[model samples]
Structure formats: structure tokens, C-alpha cells
Target chain A: MFVDLLFNLRAQGLVVGVGEWTGFLDAVGRGLATDLDGMYHLGRALLCRSESDFDGFDLAFAKTFQGMEIADDLREKLEEWLRDAKERTEGERVPHEFESMEDLLEAFRDRLEKQKERHDGGNHWVGTGGTSPFGNSGRAANGIRVGGSAGGRSAVATAMERRWEGYRGDRTLDLRELKVVLRLLRSLAHDGPMELDLPGTIDATCHNAGDIELVEKRERRNRLKLVLLMDAGGSMAPHAERVEKLFSAASQMKDTFKSFEAYSFHNCVYQWLYKDIEQLDRVATSEILAKLTPQHRIILVGDASMAPYELFSSYSWPSTTTDAGIDWLRRIKQRSPAAIWLNPDPQRFWQHPTVSAIGRIFPMFDLSVQGLKDGIKKLRVPH
Target chain B: MAEFAQFSGTDRYIADEALMASVNAALVLERPLLVKGEPGTGKTLLAHAVAETLGRPLYSWHVKSTTKAEEGLYTYDVVQRLNDSRFGDADVSNIRNYIKYGPVGLAFDSDEPVVLLIDEVDKADIEFPNDLLRELDEMAFTVRELEETVRAKQRPLVIITSNAEKELPDAFLRRCVFHFIDFPDRERMERIVHVHLPTLGPDLMKAALDRFFAFRKVAGLRKPPSTSELVDWLTVLVASGLDPASITEGDPFLGVLFKGEADLAAAVDKRRGRKSW
Candidate 1:
């Protein structure tokens, strides 16, 4: 029968009835009775309008709630549900297997705080995976999630398998592994007979009438070279790790894939990033292709998070073949049939000052990341 | 601005000496304070919430790609200026001083202490922020056309923010103290989410909170969704017509929850079969 806190705020002409008032109130209730972060949140809800204003509210909240004692006298149940403040999660990094983005964020934030606190102390700033490398290498990083494989139900496809699974739940084989299997299956395509080499071996095995034995044989051996160029930079850091896991999965599938090398780049693909224990940085793209055969497919992964200048500017990282960054990308597009810009950043951020400019230069742009079920399904490898 | 204030909480965190000190300093120091941190970290919420406690008018200038300084200050009324210039033989001096006020100007005109919210300062082009440093630092502007100076006299509380996408020019950031907002701890978040999303059952709160912490450990996330995002996620889950177990299985939102598509994709793959991996 009583009016709620939200109603009171609405009466005061300070709260909106639409959009997100309920969510705001829920957070404030949590903050009022819980932590400074909640208090900051309450301020953002009431005061800020966009991403930047949170700073003012935060400064204000920190000042106001520094010594204030929050009233936590809830009617019994709320107390037990509150996530305790002292339970740090750096050493005992728990696994979060969420089905949706919502659960991922809530669970992820919890891990972030412990590492954030560690970072705040001026220790372990450089990422060393989920385990905090400051003093705990044998343990999991406070906020990092270089998590183990989810399960075999997870796609064995290093890259495309995830896509295939997302597209068609039929895992006749891992899509990423499928790419390798396709190459392997193609490689086994030989011109010679299974148990015979040529005329002599054929005569010895089948004893065909001399001179009357005539057989036609075509030149064969699977030849498809794939060169995957991934952007390795700040923006690509997170997605790159996941993409790497996919690569690891594909590599482990002994029966499926042939050797497909991967390379990482920044403004331009720096050097090829390989799963090989010997980390090679071969600059000769042609030599690498020649050795693997031109038929190999080139798959690139990266968030083209470069300054706008990197695209059209003449002086921006010049290659021997092109004058500008855009020209260089065009050259690569010409050299390979399957060159794409696999942006790690979201599509919305694409309009962002940097991404749009880069997108303009790279025409064959696919904004999907390597992991979404649909994204992996879209990878076209010559099987 | 009204679009947001109506839905936001006006109390929870207010009237702290630190905020007042910062706000009062913005008024007195006449400098735009730069705030940096993760998105949804409440960078935008401070001004409105503080207004309730400060008992002042809060004016917000939402920064975007086309958010020029002129847009923030005053747009030229070409026809009006032309009409006034031609009709009734208005004096040149009178016409020159006839500029109207915008959000920045509104802050200058307020009688009470005002809080100016410069949301997502990082999103704008370099020039927008560059143009404001002098106005923010000196709290004064020159009207060369009128040969006059219109000083704020009482500068408003200034709050500028960047998600740290690109480092702001040093000249722009020199105006105020800097603070990095650390995301709330698990217990803190649990308490907050529990209070905000009361509709969710206890098991949900416990399970969601525990799982959330575990996630932050792996899946190298981009801008961990702020407390606000989680609150919405939980609220939607409870109201989503799905049972608790179903809610747990249906929560993949890397698309909505983070700025990186690939990161979420990777997270999904990392989570392949394991519900809690």
C-alpha cells in the first residue's frame, strides 16, 4: 500500500518514468546499502546523460560517501543475497560458463575488481593472462580469462567450426577443423594409383597385356594456400586471444587440418603469427606462399584500429607495391581472393572516428568476430 | 538531458565533501575537470546526482562526433542577425553583442552554483575539446566583433570524461585532478544488483554474482558492462518469462554488453559446452 522510493523520486520531479528508472532504483538500493561503486552508480543514473558525465558524478559521490555509513537494515532477505565485499577472487579464479551476455558482464566485473585492485597497487599491469603474474603465475590471473576449452560440445573448429555450429548445429566435423580437413582431404588427391607408382608398378600388380595397357593420369595433389593476417594491437588484444584458442583447437585435431599458418599485424600485418613452436617472422609473403603452394587460403583476423591517417596517408607505413595505406590494402586484395577485415571492435564503434576511416579503405570488410556461431560459419575454405 | 534525468536516481550518492570540493573548485577554479575510466563506470551520472545534493541547476552538453564548440556555445542566427542588422537601423554595437547562450553559456548565466556535464568528451574530434580549454581555464571569452569580454564571473562545476580510447591532449587535461574509476568488487556488485533487481530470486542473485566474478577472470572483456548494464540484465532475466535455469543458459550478450564482437565470440567459444566456463 505504501509508495516506493522510485515513486517518491518521481514525485520530486527528479526521476523519469520511462527508459530505465526501475533499473536505476535497483542499483541505488544496492549502492545505498552496499559500496561506494553503487553510490557512484546512483549518481550516474540521476545526473549524467552520456559516457563522460560519470566522472563528475563519481568525484561527487566519492566526496559525499567517504565516511557516510550506509543503512543496510533491509527486511531480512536482501542481506543474504548481497555478494560479500571481502571475497577477493584472484587466486581462486572461478569458471564462468554463461549462456548470455548479461551473466558474462556481472560475473566478469567481479573478476575485474580483484585485478583492478592489484593494478591500483602498481603491480602486474602488463597482462599475463587470467592469473595475476605479479606473484601468482602458477595460479589464475585476477581478471584475465584465458579459460580452458569449455567442452567437446564446443566447436573443434579453430575458426570456421564455430561459425558452422552457429549456422548449422550439425557438427559433421569441426568447421575450423573442416578447413584443415578440407586441405588434408585435398592434399591426398594424387595422380598416381594407391598401390602403384606408374607403368612398371601397374604391370607388376595388374599384369596388364604389354603395350595394350594404356591409362590416363592427371597431375594432382591438393594445392590451396591460405594466408590468415590478423591485426595485433590494443583493440585486437581480447579477440585475438579467443581466435588463438580456436587456432589451438584446430592444431590439436590431428586428423583434420593440414599446416595453416597464421600471422598478426597492426596497421599492416606485421609478420605471420604461427602455432609453430619456432616463432617465425618471415617478411617475404611470396616466398611463404611459394613454399606452401599458391592454392593455400589466406585468412586474416584483426580489428583495424588505426588512426584515420593510416588509411589514406601516403607516408603511413608504405609497402613496395603501393603508395598509400588504402592502395596497399587494395594490392593485397588483388593478390588474394579471400582478404577480409575481421574487426574485433563492435559495429557501432565502426562509425567511431578511427574505424570508419579504416573501413573506407578496406572494401571487403566483414565486421564479425571469429567466435560468434554465425561468424565462424561464414568462413569459406577450399575443401 | 530531460530524456535521461527522468529515469535516473537523484539520491543514492550525494552531498559528499569530495564532490562539493570538486564542484566548488570547478566554479572557483574555472577549469574543466577531465574524468577517465571504463564505460558504464558512471562517468555521466555524477552531475545529475550531484545537482540534487548541491541544490543547483545542471546543464549537460552530450559530446558526439559533430559536437562542435559552436554547438555547445551558440549557433549563429544568420537570418535573425541579418534582419536585425538591416531593420530599424539597429546600431552596429548593439547587433554585435546580441549573441544568444547555449548549454555552456547557460551554465555561465545560472545564479546558483551549476554543474556542467561534458559527457563522452573523448568521442568528439580533437578540435572540440581544444576549443574549450581557454574558455574552461579562463572562464572568459572574447567577442572580437563587439570588442568586448564576457567572463563567466561564476564558472560552473565542470566534468569532462574520456573512456581513455585516445589520450586527450595534455593542454585539455591540465585543467583538473584525475581519478581512475575501478569497477565495483563482487560483494559490492552483488549487494548493488540484489537491491536494484529485487524481483530476481535469491538463487539468481547468488548464482549470477558468483558467475559474474568468474567471467571477469577470463574472456578478456572490453569495457566490462557497468553495474547499470548488469542490473538491466538481471531485471530482464527475471521478467523474461523464463525459469531461473533457462535464464542462466540464455545470457550470451557480448554483442550488447561489450564493444568488441570478437571478444564476445571468443568468450562464447571458450564457453562452448561448459555452462560456467
Candidate 2:
């Protein structure tokens, strides 16, 4: 029986070997695992090595023991929600029962507090598969869906959301146009004679070889420091490929700037900005502000389509004392007056309340070549 | 199995209920526990803490971007062998002496169960995790030079950590139990702070936490001070004999709390505004 299970796991792309099979059998024979749960623990211990494989093992385990098919439950639910959403609104603005934002938030908070069990269909409480003004699935004029894709309705807030990965990767940047725009904000300065200009020295030496002259060259460097803050996570996932292209292009322009630094945030510039995508050692935004001087040109890349609360609320889940996203943007702008917000969200959505709110503080532009040119022009003009 | 229960709640480490449960689950199942979290959140330390508490020898493999999966298993010194065959007096026929076992190999060959930590597995190339899948699952690998297969006498308790920089392949992820170590709450932070600075007075501790939380609350600070940073800041405070109340913007020791120049300027700006009032 264990061998069959191991075979099944192998068939499902799990790397189960002879040693793990023997170990599982040994544990079973020794009565280490008598029940299904015990066997699961034993099988998992012997056959798996990394967390990346847990989902696969879970599926294999379920299929072998419970005879249940593993399916994309979340995707299916999202598709169903989309269908329901499409049926509800046929090019008509569905009127909401709640009159104000405060009423909606109040009702949502109350239901969230009382919600103990997962409710599928209800007018109250946050849960999945419900018409309640909370949770995903079912229709509600204005509710905070806990999970699933954005149903393009009155979802005031989304809790524990995965970053969106919906943007097409084929959008290529015109490097010539990019370079022209990027050159406008150059702040070059001569910082004395720093290094040997070998090529220049060689050329000059050969020309004046008859005199055997020693020529000294002073080095002038681009004094401009760039802090590129990228939006990462659920909402930025779709724009990842394009953003990556832009990031690489910017980084490759080694001669354009004296120094270039990049950091990533989720929906907004929060307390922490990660230098790496792994969410490893993040430099505090305050620290970033501290490190960068007023002369530094800051470019923020993000699609500001997050729930307004994420921008306005002081407290978000997982963070007890998070300041509003706009406050962070203001502080960044305050320190680096030359900062520009490069929005990947289309020009049409620039009118979004959250987008407009952020735009009020920092001049917002599209992520396209034209937008880049416009943003550089704005930065060049003094406040 | 009962003895394993005693390894919980070591002075060096304080795991929450959920994390402890995951650890216990990994232990009972005899699978590698893959821990994911932000930097300085104790993903690496958890392995050390577990090894210390369990009294098992810990083997660590610090993975880098250039690290290949084969380096974790064993390395065959082909150059040395070739040199010996051509010029040296020593016999090159016996290749066992030249075969150096890596952390994973050593753990597998051990007589007893040991703890193996693959630190920052995400730093490696995309193929590294996938390459590890077979050896990790089987707990055995074949060394072609020796023409011998090395099998585990005892299954090593493996712990893998990822900073979430890159997503591990689904095939690789499915093989292990997973846990994410979130940032500690204030109460948990108090416990963590106390662990690092036992001699800290209540007044100083309170003052430090207040300042730390205040820095964290600043909206635009890129990277908030983590638990380790907090500890380092407190250590600096206790060492410098600096008064907690006098610790304001422009204080030389402000470098301990904030790493960025802009952050310091912003803090100083805020302080100046307050002073003007």
C-alpha cells in the first residue's frame, strides 16, 4: 500500500526514492504511524524535503487516501464570481445601500469582529460564497471581499490578497526615447581629479610623444543619485515583466547617473522597502530618506489601484502601526522634491480616487515612453 | 518521541504556538520544515535553536546565487586526482580520500539523525531547488567518481529557508512542510527584547520600544527596524550611557536606529518643526 502511494507521488512529479520508501515502511512496521494522520506525517517526513512540494504532497495524499481530486478551487471560485458579477451589472452602475464610506467601513468592521465561522451565503459576516456585504462571491453593493480576484464591483477592501500577475510581457521600451528623457534630469559635477583616464592619457601621450609630456586629466561624474521605488506584490504582479524590462534598462544606463539604487514595496511605500524581491533585509523608508540627498531624483513605479483604505488607514492587517500610504509618499516627496510617480495603470484609471489622491502630492505619469518624457520634463522644471 | 517534546521553549528561541505546532508536525513527520519570512525574522535562527534544544549536531549550507545543487551533496577534486596520477608519489586509484562530503552528504552519512539547514535557498539559481528535490526526498545520492551510492543511515531533520525573493518551483515546494515566521507583535517583541537584553531596566526598555514603534509608524520609512535592529539599538543605548529621553533626532546614535540619510533628515525636520512650536 505504501509502495503504491509512493509510486503515485512519483507519478505526480514528487521525487520519492527507495530510501524514503524504506523509511516509510520501517515507520509503519514499527507502529510509529497507525492512523491516517500518523501515516501522513510519516510519509511527508520521508518523502518531502522542501515547502515547495507540500501542495503536491497534499494532493497526492488526498488522492491516495481520501479519493478526492485536487482541483484549482480558488480559480474556479474566481471564475464563478466573475460570471455572477457579469450577470448582475449589464453596463449599469449598481446602486449601493450604504450612503457613505464611513457607514460601509463601520458595517464591515462590525461583521468582521463577529465573524467566527466561514459563512458562504449571508448578508452579514465576512466569508466566501456569500452575497453579504463582506467576503467574495455573491453580490453586495459595497463589501470587503476576503479572497478571490477583484469582481469589479463595490469591494471596499480586499483582505490577504495575492499580488496581481495580469500584465502582458510583450510591451518593449524604446531605449533611444528613454535615454533622451532620462538625460534631462542629469546633475553632473566635477569632484576633483579622482582616477586615471587611461584611454585619454594614452591618446594624448601619443600625440605629444615628441615632447614626452605627462598629461593629467580631471574626472567629472554624474552627481545625480536615483532611488527607484518599485511596486511589488498582488497588484504589481501583472506589470512585473514590463517593470523588469524598465528596471534592467534603467540599471544598464551606468554612465547616465553617478549612483543608482532600487527598492520595492507592495501597494504603497510603507515603513519598509525591500532591496530584493525575496522580502529580505528591507531598508526603512526613513533610512532611505536619510541615505538620499535632496539632489537625488526619486522615481516611483506602481499601479495605484489598491483599496483606498490601504492608502488612508493607519492600521492594516499584519501591521499594527502602519501610516497611511499617502503619508509615506508625501514624506518621500518632501525629502526628494524631484520625485515623480511612474504609474503603470493606464491613463484612464489615473482618475481613480486613490490614484488622484497620490497624484495630488507627486506628479503622476504613465509608464510609457511618452509618459517618461513628460515626467522628466516636470522634474526638470523647478517647483 | 517523548524526548523530542522537551526540545520546546529553549531560552535562545521563543516560537509562537503556531510555529511550535509546525515544528512539532515536521518532527513527527520526519520531513524538512521549509520556513519563509522577511529578513531578520528568525528563519535561520530557528534551525540553530532547534538543533541546540534537540542536542543534535547542526550542519549548515549557506547558499549563494552561484551555488550549484551538486555542491550540497559532494565535491570531487578532479585536478588533485589528475595531478597525483601524473606527478605525485601518492596513489590516485583510491578516490575516496579526494571525495569531500558536503553538508547534505555528511548529514545523510551520519550514524544518528542531525539537523541540516539550507539557508537562503532562494539565493541560488532557479534550478537549485529543483535539483535538490531528488536527493532531499530520497536522502541518498550516487557519486559517479566512486561508483558508489551513499544512503542515509538516519534521516536528517532538514530546515530550508527562503526570503521570498523568487518563487520555488511547485514540484520542489510540494515535498516539504511550510511555515512563515511573521514579524513579532509588541508582546512577542518584549519577550524577544528581554531575551537579547536581560539587564535592560523597565524604564529603558519602555523608552526604547516607544522610540522603535514611533520609527516604525513613520509612513515613508522604507525599511522599519526589525527585531535584530531593535536589539542592536538597545545595545548601543546601554553601552553609550545615552539617556533614553535625550535620544532625539540628530543624536549621533540615531544611526543605530535609522540607516538612511533621508530618514535622518526627515526625523531632524520633524524635530525642528516641534522645536519651532
Candidate 3:
């Protein structure tokens, strides 16, 4: 019976197994989960391993148990059955004194609206006289269930709410996750000025029949230099949060890189790149290109989305000469062939003219956990 | 079969209905409960609560980066025996004297059911959990030197916690019941605070919660104040005998709540209307 639920969970991208399903069944059979609400919690506890799967679990649960609400519609069905029985018993005559139940309800509501003060003995107003149809404890037949006794039985309603949507993996890149991803860029090598190699000296002395020999080797250090070129302001504003998380994660890892530098650009890199996100402090793009070596791992963070003219047009606001924004981008990529563009925008939106053009220039990946991992893998390759 | 004790919750630990159900399910299934949550959400305290509620002995194994799964089962002190034999300090004939049981080994050796807390399991190497998969699943391990298989007298109620430093292996995760402790909502938070501070006045409680929640909303806080931090802050406030009316903006106990300098600045600045609140 729960095989459909298992398939549904798998369809929603949760890695559930037959073992987990059997365990869940065993738990339910042992009376661990007594009701539908209890089953929801029990299923989540048994099936899901991380908070990232919670949203998917909720979606799958809601889909599998859609319209299985028993408590809510019970009253309506019971009333319908009662009405049918009364009609058969009365033999083709109206059960209530009014033309229909709707008319009776309408008249009751109309009286309810007009009646102001309480009347103890009257049958007109919806008061406690045992005659009015609207009030509780009344003798009137086919009265509405007043003041509520029915409670909702739908467990799927809670699942449909999707409260854990914020915890979805693709939605946000938390600081810790970003740091973990960026830690992959660390490449430790022994390349600094030579220091005394004690082990090497001992091995050499032992091999040379006890004659003392000195050996010097370069010190081991993190030799990777990181250059971050980020798109800032204007259209890139929506992505500033994700880009900031990436930037902070990279910059905070003081031991991960030999040298780290970040510069911002608006939409496209023109003749200059701003030192700060405010775009106030500017450094010439040619100077940045001249300074960067191929050994440096350049990570470009941006949505890579802009008007076609912004990349191709020669006279696009910031640049006045014949050189367009695309020329500057190509120049940077040429200087550092190790560069990769990280688009905060989803992959589906990459078909945009400017995003694709930039994507073509540099291997692009979305700014997410998996994307960062893949990007680091690309960045790790020696040029 | 002996009936396993059910865990409703302890007086100090304010577990909601969902948490209770998850705990009960894990208990009934006799599987390790894998708890993932934000820092200060009482994931580690859960094992303690269960132990206290069930009146069982608690054994904890705090995992570190260099921690090995083998060490959790048994650590044979060969060096000690060698030193003793060399110095002629004690008898060295018995090899069993050198064999010391680790936390897991001790739990397996216990006469009664115990609650074994594997705190911060993700701190170890990626292969760490996989290495102990068989031992955890079967509740048994072999001491190769002794050539004896040590099995559990009673299946220990295992609770593993992760701050999610890294992704746990799928095979290891599949054998466990998982629960992610979400940040408590307003009502739950209130109950939690009252549980921790029974004597706290309602006025002060409202004021502290208001300030604490407001401070959390300030943007760019690298490490936001969580439930434990709130409890600590409230404890400090109550200890200082500060006026409830004085617990408005720019409370002097901001240092207790915010650990980072930038977070403190952001919170204080938000109150001053320098940034969007």
C-alpha cells in the first residue's frame, strides 16, 4: 500500500530505500504512529536524512494523500444521507415547513440579521426558545451545526503548507556550505624559499656511510591565488545575497590562498573594475589584466544577464572608445584562461543573449553547492 | 522481549509533539536517531534527556577530526603493558589487562539498556561513520588480539548528532532515524524559555524575547543568537537584577547574545535606524 508513497518520495528526489520503507511499516505496525498526524512525523523521521529533503517529503506526502480528508466532509455526507432517509420516509412531501432547506436557512439568516436584543420565549429570533432553527438545543429539524464540533482530519494539509521550503538546497547557499565548497580550491604545495630538510639530510647521511650531509627543501604552503570578479548593482542586485555569501566564504578563508582579491563590476566589465561594490573606487581593467598571471584561479560571480547592446555596443555608457564591453571580458579570460563564471541565476535562464555569450567565453556554473563543487573542480586544473 | 522505555520528554527539555513522535518511533524501531539541527537547538541534550527520562545510564563519545571508529569500540594499551614488563612493575602475562573498552564497548558491556550519545559524528573523517556501520548495525565487534567477539548484552539506544559539517554517508544514514530540529516558532520559544526559567516574570520574558527576536532579524549577522544564547542572555539578565522596563533598545547585555563584533554592530546600528530594521 505504501509502495506508491515510496515511488512518490523517489519522484520528489528523496533517496528513500526499501529498508527505510520496511522500517517505517514496522514502526507503524508497532503502533508508534497512531494517527495520520503521527504518521507524517514518523515518516519524516524514518525516511529523511537532512533538512534539504524535508520540502520534498512534504510535497510527496501531499501529492500521495490528496483529497483523503475524512473528518471535514463527514458532516456533509451525514446530512445528505439523513435528508435522503427523511424524503423516503415522508413519501414525496417536504420534510421541513419551509419550501426547502435553503429557503429555511435563508429565512433564518434574515431573521438573525434583523433581530437585535435577546428574546427568551420568542420563536422568531435565533434565541434559546427551543423553536428557532439557527440556535443550538433547538427542536427545529435540519438545523445547521452551530458553534462547531467538527475538526479537520487532513494530515496532508500540514504537508501542503511546505513550511520547510526555505531549507531547500537549491534556494540558498548558507555560509558554512559555501565555505565547505570553496575549501576545495585549496592547493597546498612546497614552493617557498628552501628550509633545512632534516629527514632528507638523515637519509642522505645514512646512504653516504655516516658522513654528515645537508639537504634543503622548499617549505610547504597554500600556493593558490584567488581573484574574484563579481557583478554588482543594477540587474545583479537580486543576486547580491548569493554572491555575497560566496565572496564572504572565499575571503574569510585566510589560510586557503596565498593572495585573495575581489573587484566588482556593474552588468559588464568595461575599461575598469570597481574595487568596492559601491562602484566608487575604480581600477583600470588593463592594469588588473596585466597584474593577473595564469596561475591565479579567477572566479567571476554574476548573473551574466544584461541587454545585448551592453556587451556588444561600443558606446555603452561607461566606455566611449571603439572597444566594447565584450572585448574587455575576452581580454580578462585570455590573460587568465583559468577563469570561470558563476551565475547566481538559475540554469534555465542562461539562454538569455548576454548570459550565453559570457557563458561561451568562460565555463559557467550556477552558484550553488554542487555548482561550486564543479566550478572548483574546473578551477583546480592546471592551465 | 523486554519492553523498551518510551521517551515523552523530561521537565527541562521542551520537546514538541513532533519531536516526541520522532523519538518514540526511533525507540520502538531500535534504530539510531540521527539529529541534525542549527547550533544551540539542544541536539546533544536530547540524548541526556532520553537517558534521564528512561532512567538509563548515558555514555557519550565526542568525535573529533582525528577520531577513528576503531577507538570507539576498543583501544588495546600495548605500550603500557610493554612499559610495565620492562620496568618489572607488574604482571604482564594477562593480555586482557591491557585491553580497555571505549565508549561503545562500555555501552555494549553494560548490564542494562543505555543511551549512547555520539556527539558531532560529522566532525570525523568522511569514512568514519562507514567504518562503524557494521558495529553500529549489529551492536557487536571483534577484539582481534583477544580473538573474542564482544556483543551487546542489551541494544543501546543510540543518538547521533551532526551540525552538518559534511554530508553523512547514505548507507549510514539509511540505518538511522533522522530529525532536523528547526528553530522554534514564537509559541514554542515561549514554552522553551519558561521551561528553562520557571521563576522568570512574564514582563521580563516578553521584553527579553522581543529584543532577542528583533536582534535576530537584523541583516548580515554572521552568527545569529539562537535558543541557547537566548537562555544564557536571559539568565544573565535575571542575575544582574536589571529592570524589565530597561530591557529596550541598546540593552547592556548585547555582548552575551552576539559573539561577533560585526553582528553586535549590525544589531546596535539597526536599533539606531542607521540601516533598514
By DockQ, the best candidate is 3
Query: Taking the tens digit of each residue's C-alpha lDDT, what string does model 3 give over B194-264?
Result: 99999999999999989888888888787889999999999999999999989985486889999988888
Worst 10 residues of 2 chain A by lDDT: A159-168
Model 3 chain A worst lDDT window (10 residues): A69-78
Question: Which residue ranges in model 3 land beyond 4 Å of their true spot?
Answer: A70-154, A184-227, A258-298, A309-340, A360-363, A369-383, B1-5, B249-252, B270-277
Cα lDDT computed for each candidate against the true fold: 0.48, 0.70, 0.81
Docking quality level of the chain pair in candidate 3: acceptable
DockQ of each: 0.01, 0.07, 0.44
Measured over the true interface residues after superposition, the C-alpha RMSD of each candidate is 26.3, 14.4, 6.7
lDDT of 3 at B269: 89
lDDT of 1 by residue, B195-271 (tens): 56645677777766654665565544544556676776666656655565654576544454445665566556555
Per-residue lDDT for A278-333 in model 1, tens only? 33443544444445443444455556667666655554333333345555555555
Residue A364, model 1: Cα distance from true site in angstroms = 35
- The DockQ assigned to candidate 3 is 0.44
Tens-digit lDDT track for model 2 on A1-383? 56567876887566776655665676566565545544565565556654334445665665565311112323334346545554544455433766544565566556545544445676776666667776767687665554545433211111112111111111224443355446655765777566777655654544443233455666777788887888877878888866775677678775678889988888888788889966686777788878777788888899887888988888442355658778888888888898898888778888788988988888888887657767877776637
Judged by DockQ cut-offs, the docking class of candidate 2 is incorrect
Least well predicted 10-residue stretch by lDDT in candidate 1 chain A = A152-161
Superposed on all Cα atoms, the candidates' RMSDs to the truth, in angstroms, are 26.3, 19.3, 9.3
* TM-score-superior candidate, 2 or 3: 3
What residue runs in model 2 are displaced by over 4 Å at the alpha carbon? A1-383, B1-7, B248-252, B260-277
